[model samples]
Target chain A: MNDKLVTVLADVFGLRREQIVPQLTKDDVGNWDSLKQMDLVVSLEREFGVELEIADIITMTSVEKINRILKAKGVDLEA
Target chain B: MKLDGAVSLITGGSKGLGLAIAHRLRAEGARVIVADIDNVALEALPDVFDRRSLDVTQPDEAKSTVEAIAAMYGRIDVLVNNAGVIYSEPLVNLMNPDGMMHSYDRFRQCLRVNLDSVFIMTSAVVEQMVLRRTKGVVINISSISARGNEGQTAYSAAKAAVNAMTVTWSKELGRLGIRCNAVAPGFVDTPSTRAALNETIIKHIEGLTPLRRLGRAEEIAQAVVAAIANDFLNGTILDVNGGVTI
Candidate 1:
């Protein structure tokens, strides 16, 4: 699950898969600016096939965190 | 260097400044939509308008109209909030100067159309922009009166708020290269201007303006194109008043 989340993050940020890790925080990434953050939100929504509300946007900080939050939001990540 | 083939949406487009801007942008090759309330005015709208009638002050109206546009056009590249109303009277002296004057309902109408509609329209479109990660431009048509207009209390306050929004939204949307800006025009000499103001007053305005004349609609349209073209010109409120506000 975490590896898949990393792949999603890498693709969203326009970075190589090897450049991202499960522990990658936004500050560590150069492309994770506000515009890119919004882009990340969109990419995640499309990846998980889930729609995020305003509050959910605040909670998605790291790859692991997004995966956890998506699961809690009833996304079937295993599939 | 161009907005050619891009999807552009202009609110309250169909008359006056908005219509002129649509004409200008379309001539530059943008696919445009003019959203307005007057059905007849919409008919005469330039071949570019791709008309959409909507009272942008209402949330449902904004949401449905934008979604419909996105469905039809695929994406929105530019949004111009040009639909607004105003009252040409002092806020306190509502009892009529000498009778035979209009009531003070100007405040309500002005606030509803000028201020409320901008919030609804931006909210509806920003969501789609965020989703698409689209680098879009939002041009909020403010007035030079936003700094301070004696007779136009509501209009001034609403435009001031629009200026504030230009800053806040620029901060919010900057990361994705989504630029937000405003153009504040002073004493523009549109057809409506000739109808609204007397000759003496218009002369006074022209005399006071450093440019010695009222501005034209196409002048403001030129500023709009500049903002959209130059990438570094984000979060700015361009004053196109011929140095009057200075």
Candidate 2:
């Protein structure tokens, strides 16, 4: 699950694979602005096929938060 | 880029020009979805085309409709923004002292249904296409009234904006390989038109037009299909209005 997310962050944020650590927050990412955040949410939805709410989107500022939200939405990350 | 297997969504597809476009696309083997605000009209749709209840003017509804359609089909290849309403009244009523002026509500409703709906639906669908990295096509149904027809102040403004956006969208989305264009039809002979205009008005319009007759709904439909099929055509507003230059 972390591996897939790392790739998405790298692809969307124009970061290297190694830079996309699980602990990386929005403040740490160079290009993570409000617009990119919206783009990230859309990309995540398209990637995972889960309809995320606005609350979920706003709280998904870090990898852990994203995982927790996805988990709550019944996304089986382990698979 | 064949119509076969392509997923196309046409708004206002329950009747008039939208239904004709649906039929044209369906005949070519495209998987089509016709969405309208009217549930009764949707119920009347044939089994070949999918039907859904959609009020394109509402922002949330527009977004969800695109999402739901994309979920059902892996991708949406085409979107025809055909849902619109026309209010044929002067900005101010001067004929009768008792008559009220064009109320703010009516003007706002016209803009909402005719102009704002196109913006809302296009943004939602385009975002989906961008995320999926899909090269898609968008055809906006404009009108010859965009050239400033009398008694259509609100409708003309809305349609003129649509034509402008067609060019702007083509420029912005062309980088992503998505094409955008519009079709401007003039006085198409539809059931709604027949009921709305009397013989004198119809005859006057026909006399002014080069073709000397009102356009058929199918004629406009053919133009839409042709625009979609032609890959090189982009940002062009194909006018099918019998050369009635105003």
TM-score, each model?
0.71, 0.74
Taking chain A of model 2 alone, its TM-score versus the true chain A equals 0.89
lDDT of 2 by residue, A1-79 (tens): 4677777888887778998776888767654545467678788888888999866776778877888998898877787
Off by over 4 Å in 2: A1-79
Candidate 1 scores an fnat of 0.00
Per-residue lDDT value at B74 in model 1: 79
What DockQ, on C-alphas, does every prediction get?
0.01, 0.01
For every model in order, what is the number of clashing pairs?
2, 0
For candidate 2, give the docking quality class from DockQ: incorrect
TM-score of chain B of 2: 0.97
Cα TM-score of candidate 2: 0.74
Every candidate's fraction of true contacts kept comes to 0.00, 0.00
lDDT of 1 by residue, B8-112 (tens): 999978988888889888988999999998889998765646998788888997998898888788778899999986555554332222432334576677888
Candidate 2 lDDT at B87 equals 61
* Position B77, candidate 1: lDDT: 86
Q: Which candidate achieves the best TM-score against the true structure?
A: 2
